[model samples]
Target: MGTDKRHYKEPKTLPDKRNKRPPKRFRRWRLISSSKAVGRFPVLVETIFVEAIIPDLVITQISNGFLHGKIPAAHLPIVDRPHLLDTVVLCIAENPRFTAPITNVTAAVGREAILTCLVEDLGNFKVAWLRVDTQTILTIHNHVITKNHRIGVTHSEHKTWFLHIREIKATDKGWYMCQINTDPMKSQVGYLDVVVPPDILDYATSADIVTREGSNVNLHCKANGFPMPSITWKRETGEMIKLPNGREVANVEGNFLNLTRVSRQQMGPYLCIASNGVPPSVSKRIMLVIHFPPMVWIKNQLVGAYEGQQVTLECHLEAFPKSINYWINERGEMISQSNGRYEPLQKSHNYKTYMKLKIEHVSQSDYGKYKCIAKNALGETDGTIQLFAIPKPSKLLNGIDNDLQDQAGSLLQDKNYVNTASAASRKFICTNFLLVLSALHRLQ
Candidate 1:
């Protein structure tokens, strides 16, 4: 076709850009802009071009004159008519990124706990919470996906995401992951530790024990809970415990307490304590009773009394499992409570007793060796006391009177006897008075 002089002119060919191709990295992109028509030609007032390439795009992006893009083109085709773009809307989005690490959480059983994940530069990507151990997805963005009602998800300003768990249980303790749906998947993990209080098992623990003296014994304590419970043994009375190795301590640790050659001194209530880091420790009280043969101890092995006087003989005895105590005469016959003449009484405390035999209106027959006996299931024991008679007060006084009379008569018949009181006579009289007092004391 021939060019018209006024309507058309020769088409200008730009030699540098006609067959130009973008670098291999960008070779498949095209640009679009607004333009104004001038006769039959258009002119560009503002250019819309991508400046840089983004290796990956997570989601959609909006542009305002500046744009981040990854296209196969170096530049857009040029136009001659009036082309302009007042506000170009080019969109480039960023992949979700973690600004802060996920924080670990800890809570006791039946309590609430929270794990936080901080993310920045999150475009349209969705964040999810997963159980690392079980590979179970707990929450996606703000929606919970787990069947557990105690689990929930929350977020603050689209940056800080939280995984909420109410009434935490031991089974819920593990590692949890906060993940983003990126090409390679971005994730951070935090641990959730759930603590549990101690609980003692009655069936597996020791109960009240009754053993013989010099025997070996073992006290066992068992408990259940998270983190495992530690067992300790302590005396309820706060007394030191003699370990099997002969070392004494106020408290012992372990599930088994070994006591070697246990004696009466070691008999009491023992406590088994179970404890963990959690609150409200538990304890069990076990009574230990040491049984032994009856033993008798005499305070006074020899006792004396005058006729028609009352006297008491006592014996202290110790035994476990209780003891049968009685008083016996020299003939080995158990003394009976006769017409209120001979009174036998027994006063007992735990494993101990005081045995008394009171002889009222004591006669010559009552003056003999008497025995106190204690018997128990283990063995029997006895203690003896010799009860001797003393002269009556009236007879002793008469003898003293006769002896004084003879001494005075002999002094008066002495040829050298002085009518006036002499030093020798006064001395003898004082000596005689002292002798009479001593005799009266012995009679009483």
Candidate 2:
């Protein structure tokens, strides 16, 4: 196409951009002009080109923003283009970045716990700690935001943010988030696990138990703590334990202890131990008291001896609350241990008692029915024994030529009692008794 220069019109004046009206969104939020002062020279504000107008872009207080970029190659040829009066130059600070990741924390009750959030280039941004479960803000920058006194905040090098919790409790266990305030908010979360030791529940556990002997008994114990505590049972006196099935065990390993055919031997303090592999394992002590009536049985109910010989009468007594045991003569008078000639001996072990009365000279008065009595808090019991005289023998009385042996020998019988003597001692008793039975004589 050939160019025709005929009737060409030249514009007299260009449209003035100064009279143009501003956009409606710029009326509420606008930027002012300024010149950036370099170290030695000044950067002209007119050189700033708007790369983009971001809608509703906010950085801290900057609600409306304009992205500044280098001038395009096509814009250099336009000499009379519109001038940009929006001169607010922004050198935006860096957004907070987590330099160190949040590590999972495990804390004990009543101990101090710390949560750290290390940020590298946190220029004007802030670091805040918020509870993930409760959504409660704990700390903001170097200042604590929550109402809790146990929560605290600290910072170092204006980057590392630390949330220090003092005297941590079990309720503080959960996820905690570390947040940074930037154009688009950033956050990281870490878990807090709180551990506690075992604690015994006194109101639920058994106390001093008082029951009758030969009755079945059950002991109960309970406890509460973190990680679900485990309970065990043990006898305080370290005696063999009698289980519910009539079996003996060294220790019981559960919260409940069953004792079958209970007796005074199983009566004492019982220990209830609770643990969960945590610190401060705890134990509770309970007392088991048994009650029963007094019981008495004679070892030797029949006795025969020579006139100048010594004789001993024995009785076995068993009772709870320790039975008071004594020996009584045929006249119904209790024998006195203070008398040297008529000695009464007593030996005790737990609920068992042994009572014996020994007379130095077996006179006619000592050869009668003797009684042993026992009394306690429950009731009383007694047993009787008989003393007999024999006639003198002629030949079989350990040598008839011996005059004293012919008229003084007699036979003694232990009334339905088991003899726990040695073989030699039993042989000696048999020889003397058989030889002396032939020389017995009754004396009125």
RMSDs, each prediction?
14.5, 11.6
TM-score of each: 0.62, 0.66
- The stretch of ten residues in a row with the least summed lDDT in candidate 2 is 37-46
Q: What number of clashing residue pairs does each candidate have, in the order they appear?
A: 17, 11
Candidate 1's clash total is 17
Question: Candidate 1 local accuracy as lDDT?
Answer: 0.73
lDDT by residue (1-444, candidate 1, tens digit) is 122235323434323333233344322223332231111212212222333222222212223433333232112222332223222213222435898887778798999999999998676678999999999999999899999999999999889999999999999999999999975688999999999999999999999999999999999999998779999999999999998788899999999999999998899899999999888899999999999999888766656567887788889999998988888899888898974799999888778898888878888888899999888899998999998764454554464457654654443333223223366764664465456657656755
In terms of lDDT, the best-performing candidate is 1
lDDT of 2 by residue, 343-399 (tens): 888899777888887788677677788888888889999999886654323323444
Query: What would you estimate as the lDDT of candidate 2?
Result: 0.69
Off by over 4 Å in 2: 1-65, 68-92, 145-147, 154-160, 297-314, 337-347, 356-369, 384-424, 427-431, 439-444
Highest TM-score scorer: 2
